[model samples]
Target: MFKIGWLRIANGLIYLYILAPLAVVIISSFHPGEYLIFPPQGFSWRWYEHVLMSGRYTEPFWNSVKIAVVTTCFSLPIGTLAAYALTRYDFRFKNAVQSLFLSPLVIPTLLFGIGLLIMFSALGVKMYFTRLVLAHIVLTIPYVVRTMLASFSQINRSIEEASVVLGASPARTFWLVTLPQVKSALAASAFISLVMSFDELVVALFLTGPGLNTLPIMIYSDIQFNLSPSIAAISSLVIVATLAIGALLIIFMQQRTRKSTDIEDPKP
Candidate 1:
């Protein structure tokens, strides 16, 4: 009983440690003062209003959104197909191929960013947006592949075999039978891709050129030159947005799981 109590206390302390900074940032964002300070001088939404009205972050914010969307769009189908192939088929050097797809997860982000920058520079590629998207695709594919691989592995192969026995083409079986089983995994992969691409800073830092700013870069620049409540406001907005998205995704996944369960085991 004492050990269990101590573990609970430890967990509570850990959560507090993680959340304390977020609370401080959210609180500081409400400060009405020009300079940001902890235990804010007064409470106001001026910073949030300023953030909304100010044109400073608008373009970068949209840029980040655009990049994240594009990255997810490209990453999802490619990763899903790769994952399906890897999980369903036994091929030459199967383990090696899987490891290759998953290598990005093990590689250091800094080194990957640097390598991409160098490769792009040497190739005389100057399209920052395209380069960034491509880099993001590479970085995000591993996550998608990993997620879908697990989902695909868990699926019953007998169902797919039955579809083939019913005269369904491989493509038809994949589309109508196999894909439906892993819809939740697809959503998860897309969400992971979107969030990772949106929040990625190191790769963006290396790839972004003049006139190609992202929200993170803008926030970083503001932090370097001017420390203001607006920074905290923007950060708070990001935090809230991330949390909301996560909550929505969780709800979506839960609904999907419930519906799938109902379909699989309908009651008369």
Candidate 2:
């Protein structure tokens, strides 16, 4: 009983630590004052209206959406392939290869961004939408690979063997058998990749030039020079968008899991 009481206290503290900032930001966004403040002087939707009407905010928000969508599109396939190769097949330097793919997660984002910027400059490569898309993909692929790897580990290999034994080609077996088993992982990875790419600022700060600004970069720039409640409003919108995507992904995975279970355990 003593331990249980201690655990409850610890959990409450953890919850406060995680939620305190979020609560403040949400409250501050509605401040009647032009500047941000906690226990806002009064409630108003002026900041939210300002954020919605400003092209500076809307443009970057759309840029972030495009970057995240493109990044997820490219990262999912490449990450899934890397996950499959690492998990299913025995190859030379298998562990080393997996480590290399996941290394971005450990490396400092600033360092990675600096290195990429230097390389692109040396190549005389212009920073364009396509280049920004590629940069986001690099940051996002590690999350995809990690999530898919977890899914691959949980799946049974016998299903793939059975498909092959029934005269399915290797590619067909993978598409028809292995892919279905790992669909939940793919869904989860895509959502994770979207969230990572959407909120990423460090790499964008180095790699993006004018006209390629992302939402987080815009927010950072605003905070550096001003303390407007509009910034808080933008942040609250981002938080809502992130949570909506996460909830949708969860529903998709849960539905897929139920369908898979029904297929595997059919009854009269």
Candidate 3:
């Protein structure tokens, strides 16, 4: 009981450490002051209005949404296929291949970004949006692959094998049997990949072309030149949006899990 109490306290403290800055940012956004400060002088929505009304912020935000959406579309299919292959198939250098795909998680993002830039230049691909999406896809795939692999690990392979042994084609088994089993995982991976894509900044810094930018890039530029409550307002909005989406995903995954289990369980 004592150890459990201590653990709870430690966990609470860690959450405070993580959430304190977010709380400050939320509070600062509502401050009436032109400059950001902690414990805010007073409450107002001027900064929120500024961010919502300004084309400067909205354009880059939409740019991020476009890049993230396209990146998710490209990354998820490739990542899911790669993960399935690695997890289910035996091959030469399989461990090495998995390592290569997951190496980005250990590698420095700046190094990865620079490497992509050089590789793209070597290939003579110069389009801005094309380059950014490619970089994002590279960055996002490893995450999708990892999440899907973990989720796949939880499922029983025997079920899939039974489907195959029952005369179902591999494609049919995957679509009807395997896909349903991994649906929640796919949703979770999609959420993670989308978040990583939207929150990406390091790769964007290198791959972004003239007149091409993202929300993070805009925030970076703003921090470098000027700091204001407007940025805080944007940050708070992003936080709220992320929390809302995350909550929805959690609820969806939970409901999906319950439904799946209910379907599998025999009636009493």
> Which runs in model 2 stand beyond 4 Å of their true positions?
1-3, 258-268
lDDT of 3: 0.90
Ranking by lDDT: 1, 3, 2
Query: How do the residues 6-38 of candidate 1 rate in per-residue lDDT, one tens digit apiece?
Result: 899999999999999999999999999999888
Candidate with the larger TM-score of 1 and 3: 1
Candidate 3 per-residue C-alpha lDDT over 1-268 given as tens digits, one digit per residue, 9 for 90 to 100: 5789889999999999999989988888898987778878988999999899877799899999999999999999999989989888999999999998898889999998899899988998778888888888888889889988987788888999999999999999988988788988899888998999999998899988788889999999998898998999999999999999999999999999888778889563
- What would the TM-scores of all predictions be? 0.95, 0.92, 0.90
Better of 1 and 2 by lDDT: 1
lDDT of 2: 0.88
- What CA RMSD would you report for each candidate? 1.7, 2.2, 2.3
Number of the predicted model whose lDDT against the real structure is largest: 1
RMSD of candidate 3 to the true fold?
Answer: 2.3
Clashing pairs in 3: none
Ranking by TM-score: 1, 2, 3
Tens-digit lDDT string for candidate 2 (122-234):
99888567777888888888998898888888888988989999999999998999998888888888888988888888888888886678899889998999778999999
- Model 1 steric clash pairs: none
Residue 53 local lDDT, model 2: 86
